[model samples]
Target: MNRRETRDAVVHFGPDADWVREAAAESSAVAAADGVASYDEPEADAGAADAAGARLAVCELSPDAGVEALAAVRDALPTVPVLAVVADADAVDDALAAGAADVLVRRDGVDDTALLARRMEGVAATPAESRLGAESTAQLLDAIDDSFYALDADGAIRRWNDSFSRLTGYEDEELAGMDALELFAGADRERIAGAIETVVETGSATAKAELVARDGETTPVEFTGALVTDADGSPSGIVGIGRSLTERREREARLARLRQAVETIVDRAPLTLFEVEADGTVSTVRGETLPERLGRRVSEGDAAEGVFADQPEMRRHVAAALDGEPAHGLVEVGDSTLEAWLQPALDETGRVTRAVGLALDVTEREERAVMLDQIQASAGEVIWISTPGKESMDFVSDAYEDVWGRAPETLRSDPMSFVEAIHPDDRERVEAALTEQREDPDAYEETYRVVRPDGEVRWVHDQSSGVYEDGELTRIVGIATDITVRRRRERELRLKNRAVETAPVGVAIHETAESAGPITYVNEAFASVTGYDGDAVAGEGLSALAGDDTDSDRLHAVASAVKTGDRGSATLVLYRADGTPFWGRVDVAPVVDGDGEATHAVSFVQDVTESKEHEQEIERHLTEFGEVLAEDLGVPLREARDRLDAATDDDPDADLRRAEESVERAVSLVEDLATVHSFSVEPRRLSESMRGSSPAPAGRDE
Candidate 1:
């Protein structure tokens, strides 16, 4: 080849003057030594290479030269091949990514001068395509949604489609001087450069990289690139396609979140998720269950056999689910019961792949339901609940039939029927109490009579309390107890009280005590006889009618009888309500309780004032008569008897005379007694001296 024909023209864009000079000198020395030509165009304009008829473009990219300057040279001559020289070996990937046909990293005193000359010779010998062919290819690249770009040997952006501009939100003018490495976030630029380097070395490469958007937001992009070669089979640049993965990544993240949520629910819930194969074999199980790990088929497990024994229907349901039908049923194993639901799992072809099942334990709930049934059947009291203010009862126990003479179902259907059973006399009062309880949501209690269909009247004590929710009455729950026997005994007690109040003799009852034994009851006769009203003396001591002059011994005797639960009587001097004294014959008896202790005392009192006065008068008369006999009649008789005794001893005739005189004296004594009798019979008619004085001789003191 001729020297001019073998020599190739080169354009360099490095702003580092010293590096440019050195690179050019090295490249020229190698070209001359290798029998290739070199024409270095340092600090060249965009069109300098076309005017100089350059064979290859050489961009010397110093650390400061960056991607933009080199890209400007490459864009100026799209048909020519370009080579890049860089100072740092680490910048090789960036140089290759920017569309470098070949890169040289300058090491101190270590030159790849011969390699550079050969690469330039190969690029210069390659034929360039016509402008029309280039224009048509550019039009096709710009029409795609993905970003397409061409990078030079210097790793400078040479050409890019409109999609590239749209993806980064940059116009052609703004992108003209922009470095390709500046398109990514600071941290991702190296990674992107590495991926681009792989594409240049591997002929074709695919990787993920981060691209910075116009607003400074970074997006993930999938890059596919292939090296573009010159006619002589020398790498010239790279043609790349970048598809933004923003939407696809977002979809994947959402799927991950949804999967996490479902797993959380499965872990926390009481449900068990199971999978059964199409052949009716258990494949997997999750959540709370009989085992932590299971590998055998459902038929191989002992639990499955136990379930089949108690719930034959479960197998059928599971089978149906495996056949692409949804099914559910209950299965009991030992003491536990499970509610199992199953649905078919499908494949992409809509065929049944397996059955997915969920199981929940319902043992406690079923047992509680049975317990409630037992209580409702056996309870004696009528247990019930109802909606607040509603006429119909929500639930009622079977005891309603025995107590209210109506079925529980009847009351539940028409609660008014229970109210209608209330005795007519107490109906209004019972209803009023219920209304008040509803208004206040307090406890309800009412005792009223209920008239049965058989005309039997029975008393019932109904009690209820409101169930409140958010300060409002929601329901009423209560019990109604039969109290007929109790009410009947109360009625009898009232009749007995009426009889005691009207009793004839003075009757008083007092609590048993040593002192201040307060009177609790006083009959009408007691009030009249003691001259103290029953109301006035009730709570007063039993000795209220007994004055201070009353005998202490008699009072103690009555108190002792009451304290010891004994019976005793005393004729005591008692004062009336008017302060006048009277003799009373009182009989005291203790009222002992069931415990055999005297709790109270009852007394029967009678007035004996008139009879005692008459008896006293008779005793006074006897005493006066005795004095008359001794002093007046007895003295004369004694003198006569002495005379008679002397006569009898001296002469028989004289003894007879004495006896006659004694007889006469005895007759005189009789006469005196008669006079006393007359005074007793007519005391008021006698003089004041004769009334108190004995009827004796005048000289004698009576």
Candidate 2:
């Protein structure tokens, strides 16, 4: 390898010539030792390069503008390759935009002399036909890749180069009087026309357009022109270069797409993008959720070997990248699963030099996928995802088979097939609603009936939402639930409510029993029977209805059992709102929950006043009759007993025994009559006996 071939010395000019000299010396020593691209300095006193012959000009420019200094250097050594040096990275752009052939920041290239020298060599290596201050304008224009042309003030072409001829497919004779604007078509033509007009009026102009050729094919070109003037300062024509922007635009579009994809992942998922050198040193680390040693932030230039000490797999990925092979897969990092892709970056020599790694934190996405699997197995909801504007369904969960009674694959193939499952009565309405939602896709809610393949109708409650970015819909997610059972229960509840309202018996529904809450609801019959409207009876328990004549002990027992979620019934003297006492029969039943713990109580109340009063009257008459009989028969029974005793002889004759038997039988008849009247027992006492207790079956009985 001929690494040493003597050329010309690279001139160094700046405030820091010593710094330039030091870097130059290192490169110069290597070049001189091997006799390669070398630069000889002018005498120390001269403070300048041989202007007409210097291979390259290394000029240091002011960090602020550097415009004046750059102009002066270019003016003196017009043909030399000028590499501008700026203080910071930002100034590099300014210098380059200000007509610099190349630029290097002081901090980046100053310490790396060989790198700087190589950059200088590269600029110097440019063909003289492509460089500024070429020996002949015709030679330079012909050598340029861009189409060059000079046109008159009226847009008529005056002069042109081979590139222009090749670009437009027109010979000199054909282009002799053609208008410059005619070289373009469509919007490109109009824009170039405006740009040409601007150049004629404003002295200089730059614009991008497509130049049309004789064959109708167009090439994207960036046209930059300067107005040429005659001696009297009158615009004569315009000299311009039409640089083809095809490659540049294509490259930019590719980069934009790549950036968009990466940015989208970074926005939604936690991720880390990194670059590692061939020696296992991390050059850059950005984004999120990448595990670090002891929770430290990953820094640039950190040795990958140390940072990933415990991760042998990660080390292998980096090694693979360095070995010119790409690796990608799912990797667990702490509690998250990261989808990693490692791609190798190579130099011009095709040797793998670096590894670009992307670790997308797919933890939530993976978990959601797992949750969808579980939902498919047991959940009643069918999940679906559609493309933007719902043009197509991207994915439909397996649960679709359960809810929609159609295969998931069927729906995926034809997104609108779910409409077929909808009941005919609702299909048109659902479709209309969906059409209306397209313009405004947010929280869309709907409930309709679906007719399954088996002809079973299922009530479905479907809801969907659109995922938007920058006010543009990007995706639509939907869930449809099989709510048939819930709908059935609701219908049953409504019917039962109507029945309870219309029933003849008064009904009171207590919300809770063990906790002892007030009645939550009561049928109209209750208000009519008790003479207490719902408002008047608010917060009042059944025991509150007890009047003075009410069986207090029995009422307490019934009230106590109802509160503790026990079933009980009793007819008690209760008062209405008008201070009227009535015999009310109350029967309560406990409502227990799934666990058999009583939650509420339902009581059926009936007015038993008429029957109760009649019973009382019967008991009163029986008592009076018993008193009268006792008054009339008490002395006779005693007198008979004495006579029988007097008539009886111990072992007397048969006539004496017959008389004694007659007297005893009459006494027994009177005794039986006396006890028969005393048999009228109270209804309250009977209830107590039924409960197996005499005193209201005690123990917190209230």
Candidate 3:
């Protein structure tokens, strides 16, 4: 047996039991070899176990003495490890049932003393392990929130608590009997091993290192270890408590980010920081040269009182802060406005210790607000603001009363009443816009008519947008503009357009350009006169109307005048849709904008074909009349000359008189021919009369 001496072990036996002394002496020799100084007590009774410095008890029971002696020893030294030495094998069961750590039998082939010593050494290890295996140790380990593990001297994991499994993701089956150092990596493994060694060598040690989990992820952990000892005060193993640092590190990082943000704000903003003591005194004052205000009570007479004079409720805020509530308010100090926020400082026990206050200069903000109010008053449009989805107006400028002709107070009291005032035809559209604004809260724009209390209808162009806080719609601000004049002009234009469309004269409007402008629109009359549809000529140049007999020069003149934004006329024969030609007059004028730029050209076309035919007839009639007159005068002259030649010898007065008569007769006939009723007589009779022959009478001429 490999053994060394340890503490003395108590042996309880009868006076006749001398073999125990021999066994004790041999066991001491074995224990001493194992580095334990063991002393054997042979005559010690069960009651004297503590006096003997007993680490374990060896009970001797004779076969006839029964197991009663072993039971008695067990009852006396219940905590001490016991080995029952029995000569009869049958008594082994009884000795074990009496709470013996083991049973040693004295047999013939076995060296009884050596066998008893070996069994005693086995029992020596039992007392300490038995105490640890008690329910209380497990309860104590499991009660802790942090992880715990026990490792043997060989660095093998022996026991682990529930938290160990949760933290490292290693169940009992996976971690049992594995090397505990395998849970770490790189220098962390070496460091943790060294820490465990230090704990074993000394009493305890603490270390911080990273530990690996099942998925090969490492977590920083704080480890505290202490050496575990047996009842004999010999080092056994290490029991360590390990706490994960993940949440702690995350919390620290979050706090660092918040501090950085606050620092950035403080650096950029004009602010004063003050610390208020629990007794309502300002202990520290920073920023804005307020050093003299420190250690002063925040009351009526203090320097801070002037700053908070406008905010009388500040006293209640301070009281609330001291009672563990946060507060904030705005106040005016001198000519400057300041916004103040106060937070309670809490101690470990959650009691309010003090208050930290930050005050920011808001003078610029106040000035801007005042400037906005002035802008609203000076603006011509109606300026209004309201809470989103609420039927009440928060603010409306003076223009509201002028535009809607209703008192602002009434609209403010019932905002929906404004919707009721909307023209019935436009009310549904306006309500729909309001609903859409409430749902999406984006910029809203709509033009609708409103009916005033005076029964005058006015058109309003409303444009609005939502105010948001944290991505939620909070309020709506908008402007309403009167577009009534523009709408009235539009109506007048529509009526004018209708009149032009149905006019008697053919009207065609053309686009104005540097060259011949394109025809854009043609009235129904123009279509009827041309036999060509509007679509055929629209976008076509004015030359599209010219055909075979069209007077190109006159058409060019008209087109040039229209393109140059002037009025011009052209009388030319234009071809009809069926290839027939007729005389037409085209009058073109330019349409110009306020900038005097010609945007369009309008032309009026008149068909003067009948008048032109009548003029041709008149010219023909005049030509015929001249031919008739010439013939009548020529015959008279001929006859008169013949009479003069034949009667040369006769009286000259007589021949002259004859010529005079012919001349007078020709004059009379010309006069009668010139009469309006001359065309009613026969053309031959007129010819005969002009021949200087008497009328043959109507029947004879026929």
Candidate 4:
């Protein structure tokens, strides 16, 4: 090419004057050899670069001036291809962010001017349509949601999107062509530069950085950058997409705060907190000096060597938690004690990532429980706690051993063992009562029988209450009192009552009232007399069976005498079941209590109806016989007597004596019959011995 056809480029010196001079001299020599002219000074107004028709701006930027100064120079000449040169790798980021066309680090055997001139020749040879196509591509990227930017080989921001403006609080007019390093906070500039070199060499980079916004606010962001490549797989530039993580960061901060609050609370409690990783490394997060005992990581060797020497159960709990189930309650830890609550930690996908735990110091509570156990063991009742699902006994007072004739340890190991000890007939009732109580807490007080270890059966009275938490029944606490003696006594009393009710007598023991007269104490004979069962007239007083013709005055007189500590008797016509009248002689006497006071009246009532009838028949016969005898003896009494006396004297007086005896017997029989009728109509002698004991059985004959 001739001098007029040679391509031209511009070389500008920045803060590094020495590097700029050396580069300018070399570029001048190379341009001369290629028949092209290069300048270290600013291009002349309009006519200077028409020979080449295009310009390559090579600027030496000072480390101190950074990408900002380079950006200003690029803005001053908008159509030029700028190539930035740095003496150190630390300046590569600013150079690229400032929109350098290419970057050359200070090194031996590198031809700076020849390199720039040759690169300018290539740009100059490109068609205007290709450059327009590149600009159009950049504009399309500016419409994306994420802040997208392109870095030149010199590590400057060659292109940026409108989203960048929104993220950094900067307008396109203010920051469209700014340097990438200017967007980073002051402290992050060097780190950003290092990352840029890494991306250029490695073809990709990812990091979290704090960037300075237009408003001077520093916001956290995640930056992902990849090396833009040419057709030959050589690095042409870098394209980065930045995601503002302020919201995510804030959420993480809040979560951290919550965790801290939980740790504070848990640490202050009488509990221990732990976190177990998926690999079975347990870390104690809180409680006592656990942080000292259990370091940050629990090694496999340590675990195998019994590293948790003081708490072997912790390993089991961790294993359980890792399996996605919680392990809780008191566990032995060395010589101390712990009440642990364990749960699994989940990742974003809801898969178990680790296990966490909280443990409470239950030493004192255990001691108190032991003391309670001793007291309950000595007590006469059984106390126990049943967990949900009725699977096992959560706790059992020591009285279980004494009451059930089994060891409390055995019962605690298996609550169903105790349930199995219950009598088969009582098992259903006991289970029903428990179910009812669980459903309705107010249902309690169940009675059942349990067979002891010695095979002796005893009745137990159980009262239980359900323990509810979070609207679910968690456990049940119950007290059982033995009622064997009371049950036995009740059985015996029932048998005695049956015997008394079935007695074969109309015997009644009447209670005396001050105002009421003596009550009936009818025996079997009275029931037979009235043709009424004793139960039918048990509560009726003596007057209940009396006939209408009976005298009230006489009955009251007899009752008054009996009430005054004197025995009395009366004969009254008693009504039968068929309403027939019958004569009954009632003897009434006072029955006294231990205090020598009259408690009741005892009356012995006999059915004299047949006896009275027999006597009437006798009297009739006697009257008739006596009248006949009178007629037969119609002769004069003296003559009959003399005749009888002469006949008796002559006949050895035997016949006369026998005749007189016969007459005397006939008169006596008439008199006795009259006396019997009189006695039936009047009161008779009463005696205490004649009192009846109680009521008689049904249908007894008198």
Q: Which is the leading candidate under TM-score?
A: 2
- C-alpha local distance difference test of each model: 0.69, 0.71, 0.70, 0.63
Residue 321 of model 4, lDDT score: 82
Per-residue lDDT for 1-702 in model 1, tens only? 112343345544544433433434455332223332323333345544442455566677656444444555556666656777778765554455445666777677865655555565555565565221456456656765778877776677778889898888888888774777888766678877887787666665667788888888777898766666553346677767788899889999999998787678768866677766676555336675434322122343343434344467777877788778999877776567778898998999999988787777778888998998999888888888887785668888888888888777787677768889999999999888877876754567889998888888888998888888997778888888888888889999889888877777788888776555677888888887788877888777657877766887998788667666689899877878877667688898888888988888888887765555456557556857666675677667767777777777788785597577767768677677756655565332322322233233345454
TM-score of each: 0.46, 0.54, 0.46, 0.40
lDDT of 3 by residue, 1-702 (tens): 112234445434454234555655566432232232222332234444452456666666665445545555655666666677777765554454334667887776765667766676666755465532346456646766778788887889988778888888887899999998899999999998899888777656789999999988888998876565543446667666788989889999999998877777776768777766786666435554333222222443243344344557665667678889999987656577778788999999999998888878888998999998898778879988888885678988888777788888887889877788888999998899888887765557889998889998889999888888998878888899988998999999999999988999889888886466878888889887776678988777667778866789999999887788889999887766766565679998889899988888999988776565456546557646755885667576657656665565476677576776676677666665556334534433333332332223344333
| Predicted model with the maximum lDDT | 2
Candidates ranked, most accurate by lDDT first: 2, 3, 1, 4
Q: 2 or 4, which is superior by lDDT? A: 2
Candidate 2 lDDT over 1-702, as tens digits, reads 111233445655555655555555555322232222223321121224354445677777654323445555565567776788777664443344334678877674336666666676677677765665534546656776767787887889987778889988888899998988788877888898888888776666789887888998888888777666543446777766777888899999999998888777765656678888888888545565344421457666778887676667788888888899999887666776777789999899998889999877678999998987787677668888887556689988787887677788887778888888899899888888788667655657889999989898999998888888898878888888889999999999999989999999998877663345467777899988877767776666776577777898888777776788888888787777766666789898988999999888888889875566457657667766766767677677678767667766445668767777776786676667677666655554443332341123134352
List of clashing residue pairs for candidate 2: 4-34, 4-35, 4-36, 5-35, 5-36, 8-38, 8-39, 9-39, 9-40, 10-39
RMSD of 1: 18.7
The parts of candidate 4 lying over 4 Å away from their true place are 1-381, 425-447, 507-702
Between the candidate structures 2 and 4, which one is better when assessed by TM-score? Answer: 2
Error of 3 at 269 (Å): 5.1
